[model samples]
Target: MEKITNFSVRIVQKYLPSAFVLAVILTAIIFVLGITIADQGPMTMAGYWGDGFSKLFKFGMQMVLVLLTGYVLAMTPIIKNALNALAKQANTPKQALAITIVVSFICYYLNWGFGMVAGAILARAMGSSVKVHFPLLVAAAYGGELVRGPSSSIPLIIATPGHFMEDAIGIVPVSQTLYSSWNIALTIGLLVLLVAFFLLQKQPKDIIVLEEKEEIIETKVFEGKMCFSDWIEHSRIPTLFLGLLAASYIINKIISDTFSLNLNTMILIFLALGLLLHKNSASYLNAAELAVKAARGIIVQFPLYAGIAGMMTNAGLVTIFSNAIISVATIKTFPLLTFLCAGIVNFFIPSGGGQWAIQGPIMMEAAYNLGADPALTIMAFTWGDGWTNQIQPFWALPLLSVAGLSARDIMGYLVIWLGISGIAIAGTFIILM
Candidate 1:
């Protein structure tokens, strides 16, 4: 096991390009695929690529905030202290990996943004205190995303009213999808597989722990008499007021029973909690400054991915791909095949909402014709979208940034879990759904 893992890590580290380079490479490859498969002209692909940049611009910024807000929330003094306490629990490498996976999976099961940032930061905390293979540890942090299939995002999309496909399939409520027996079973089943599989991977001898940095609290010390401006800088009143404003709306959301724990609401919650926990403007802004550093990777790389999505959709590649895969599906095979199709498409279009916009309609329509259950189909598509994320670099940006590792540093370990999860998710859909 150790030899195989070492070989995989060595090969990926030697050959895998940086995430940005991989995005550009994916762009070029997609451009060519557009020409060959979709028979799109170069100008057409370029047009799609350019236009598609705007498609994900808003979503990209949302991701940036996801990293920023999540980071800011994680950096608060209370959270930092909590992480330090948690870090002390793991004395061995195996224990470190196990705890990281459990923590990450739970966070991911709650909100992708929280899971993505907190998991990575926690891994860093663990690496600092425990003698573990840092890459494998980070990979375990990321592996928690496996639970997103049922907890949020893709499933939430189809369940919401006014979704792109709602007019056709009607609104598939959360009770039918997220809260279903099959989905609950699959989620639990996959998590067990993820934990066991992650723990089994061999740890490396050459461990890379995080470099110690200065304390996060940054106060402007004025030895002389303090001025009014300096007084405001240290004031907690601003944060108190800000927290109250955000908290009021959240209160209304829960009071009305409208809070779905969706990504948007989760971000708001993070913002409110971050502000309240920081207690003062100085600590809040200090955390914000460092949060930007962690968010930089997400800011630059997402547009490239958006353009890739544009190319795939514009060139009709997503359509072509989805149709080809689902065309041959039977009732039992439809769910599994749709999952298979989604996993393949996710490499090019990593965004769950983006893929669902194009492929969701196709698969949902195909499900109706084949007599496959709509909710089951949704779960299958969700699994496929997340399944390939094991090796996909786009979604890993935020986690990798906070963990201070490159994509190659972790992808090798994830590649193995990708297969394990593939079989588990695929088998669940086939046997049960």
Candidate 2:
């Protein structure tokens, strides 16, 4: 295990390009696939890719805020102190890996956006206190998100009243899917196994000591010489008022929307927390400015991903891939095949909701035609969505941004877990379905 882990780590560290370059390579590959498999004309494919490149601009901005807000909130003195306190719980590399996975799992199970940011921040905190392998820690943090349930986009969408295939699937109340006995059992077992797996892989000789950088807090020097601009920047009253305002909305969302902790809500919470924690607007802005640097990859790389998604989606490549898998599937093998297909499609369509929108109908139709359980089929898709996320740079953007690392730095370590967990999920479906 140690030899394999070291070999994987070394290979990734040596061969993986920077995240931006990887995005470009993916774009070119997808373009070639579009022309060949998708039967798209060269000019037409470029047009689709061009249009698609700008499609995620808004989503990218939201993600930028997600990382920036989360970073700023983590930088707050109170939050930093709390994280440091948590870090002290892990004395050794193995303990740190275990704790990081458990914490990241819970956070992501609640909301993936929250999990993405929280896991990265927590890993960094844990790394500061223990001589843990930073790349593996980040990978474990990401790997923890594989436990899909009601919090996941596809499950929640299917559980909702008016999803696209409402007549076919008919509002699966998570009990039959996410909250099912098998799912719950698998989730718990997976968590235990992951903790043990990470522990065994932790070698004393391989521990990487990461230096936690000191945060520079800016403060107003003189109150006597304060002009209106300085006063506005230094005043706590305005920021406090805005924080209270944001808090009110968040509380309203929880009360009125019934425990709504979606990505938007998570962002708002981070924003409010940052405002409340910092002394004034200027301090908060300064922290935010520093955090923004972390999201540079998102700003540059997401459009390229969006473009690739466009080529795959617009040219019917996703459907071709799904059909290819379906062609080889029997009733017994349908769920497992669907899972494998979803895992493959995830490389193109990284967004859960988006993947479901495209592949859900096709999978559901096959499920009904073949007399397979609808709930089990969708769960297979859910597992597939998570299975490939380990190596998919798209999902890693925010976490990578926070960790100051690239996808290659951690993907080699994570790919091993992807195989391990994929087998677990696939086996569960084959036995239970």
User: Tens digit of lDDT per residue, candidate 2, span 1-433?
Assistant: 7788778878987987776777788788888998987888999999989978887776667767767776787677786677667789999877888888988888777656557767887899888878777888888888887778545777777877677889977888777888889989989988987887787875546555566665476775884677888888889998899999999988886778664434456678878988999889988988887676666666777778788877887888877888888888889999899989999888766767667877899889988988988889888999898888887776787788778777877887787787788888889988985
After TM-score superposition, the amount by which residue 89's alpha carbon in candidate 1 deviates from its true location, in angstroms, is: 1.5
Tens-place lDDT per residue, model 1, 1-433, is: 5566667778998999987888899999999999999989999999999999888776667666766777788778787788778889999988888888888888778767678878987888898888787888999999878676333577777766677787888877888877888778878887788778877776555667666554356777789888898888788899888888999999998999887655566677888999899868988898888777767766787788889989998789888888888778899889889889999888878888777877788888899988899888988888888888888887787788777778998988888778888898888887875
Clashing pairs in 2: none
Model 1 C-alpha lDDT versus the unseen true structure: 0.81
Task: Give the backbone clash total of model 1.
Answer: 0
Off by over 4 Å in 2: 149-151, 159-176, 202-207, 223-225, 253-261
Error of 1 at 246 (Å): 1.5
Please list all clashing residue pairs in model 1, or write none if there are none.
Answer: none
Best by TM-score: 1
Q: What are the runs in model 1 whose C-alpha is more than 4 Å off?
A: 149-151
